[model samples]
Target: MSLENNKAFASVLTAGIILLASGFAATMLYHPQDLEENAFKIEVADSGAEVDAAAPAGPVIEPISALLASADIAAGEKGFKKCSACHSIESGGANKIGPALWGVVDRTRASVDGFSYSDVLNGMNSETWDYEALNEFLAKPKAYAPGTKMGFAGLKKVDQRADLIAYLRQQSDSPAALPE
Candidate 1:
């Protein structure tokens, strides 16, 4: 090879070697440590203990009817803002990513005229959008209908779900009666 070509090749080879060495050094210095040392240790209850150690931890969910009695419509409207991206609750509102929810409270499931529904939801056509059903579905859409296309994570708070339901009920000309 010519002198000039030899010099250029050497420069490129040196640069590549430096980069490879730096990467190897970084990998060695930042190597991941064992996480077992920081792992949480769950305390198992004794055979005579009142609580069941195997039972999952979390608050017990109350019935939907109980929550609706104290639900504030105004707060629901505010919370509905999160849903506005995919749903339109106004009467005669056009469907967005989700079907229009104007009269969804008592309407048949997956009955929206032009909107496409997931196979899971369509199969549930016999069901009505009653308070209890709405409560369960709003709490976790994927859990309620495993193959549902709705990407919403669901409302975690019972009060928020009740408020949202209340606001939806108001959108209809003849709202469904609250659960007893």
Candidate 2:
């Protein structure tokens, strides 16, 4: 072949090779793996104990009142760091990602002016931020009020939640009475 034809042939060959390699790589990457026959097998309990698959996991949380009795406001202030990203506890504090929490304790739900609240919160317009309500909400925001806009993963430790709630109570002009 002439020099120009040879160059053209080489270029076509290189293009064809690249195309074939890309196709091979794509097939390898996109191919689904076959699941093993035992992939979904339920393991038999060796101890002869019955397992209830439908039962809820985790320990039942105690009432917030019991926890609040010994809640440490200082520790709660520290725990408030997690909330500071979204909330401002200072009186008359400007709303950030969340509504300012200056008087959140005992305050009506979704009552902040100018801040847009989620429909879930708005639906609870008659509800107050009482201790039990706050605890339940904090324990599992999604569970307490499904479709809540609060992104908190929920405080797992009861004491930490109490502390956080205490700190919030202190932020108010007139803090709500602690649970008996």
Candidate 3:
């Protein structure tokens, strides 16, 4: 090949290599995994089929009441470090990114003054945060309250949630009684 043809071939080869490498790197950086279930479904009006709404797919969370009796408050407090960035567990503590959780265990949901709660949570203001409620919420925040602004993905472990609840229960001046 002539010197000019050689140079041009080299440039084309380098460009082709770069293109292939970038495409491969992009795929590696963003691995698109197949979802276990459909994220959302739109029902066809004329399908004429009964569509039973199914719960989101995940392990069935066992109630944490039995776990709370023997749950380690110290470990729970340790777990709170992860939550401290968003919540304040101290009595009379000001709200951070999330509402102050000082007395959140049995407190009314979305009742914290001055802290803006999501519409979904505001709708649930009448409800109280009992042990079971906290358990479920801790396990999966989004699943419990869809469209909630709380960005925490949620603690996945049952024991971790139970312990965290135990610690939160102590943050109150008058702690709510543990579930039997």
Which numbered prediction scores highest in lDDT against the true structure? 3
Between candidates 2 and 3, the lDDT winner: 3
User: Per-residue lDDT tens digits of candidate 1, residues 1-180?
Assistant: 799999999999999999999999999899787886657775332454487779874444556787777889999899889999999988899999999999899999999999999998999999999898898899988767777899887888888899999988888989888877
Instruction: Write down the RMSD of candidate 2 (Cα, Å).
Output: 7.9
lDDT of 2 by residue, 1-180 (tens): 699999999999999999999999999889787876766776332452786889775457667787776889999999999889998889889999999999999999999987898898899999899998888888988767777788887998778888999888989889898888
- Candidate 2 residues lying further than 4 Å off, grouped into runs, are 1-16, 22-60
Predictions in order: lDDT: 0.86, 0.86, 0.89
Local error of candidate 1 at residue 21 (angstroms): 1.1
Q: Give per-candidate clash totals.
A: 0, 0, 0
* Per-residue C-alpha lDDT of model 3 across residues 30-143, encoded as one tens digit per residue: 988899988987432234266456944556878999998899999999999999999988879999999999989899999999999999999999999999999998998877
Error of 1 at 91 (Å): 1.6
**What's the lDDT for candidate 2?**
0.86
How do all the candidates rank in terms of lDDT, highest first? 3, 1, 2
Error of 1 at 180 (Å): 2.9
TM-score of each: 0.80, 0.72, 0.71
- Model 3: residues with Cα > 4 Å off, grouped in runs: 1-59
For residue 99, model 2's alpha carbon misses the true position, in angstroms, by 0.8
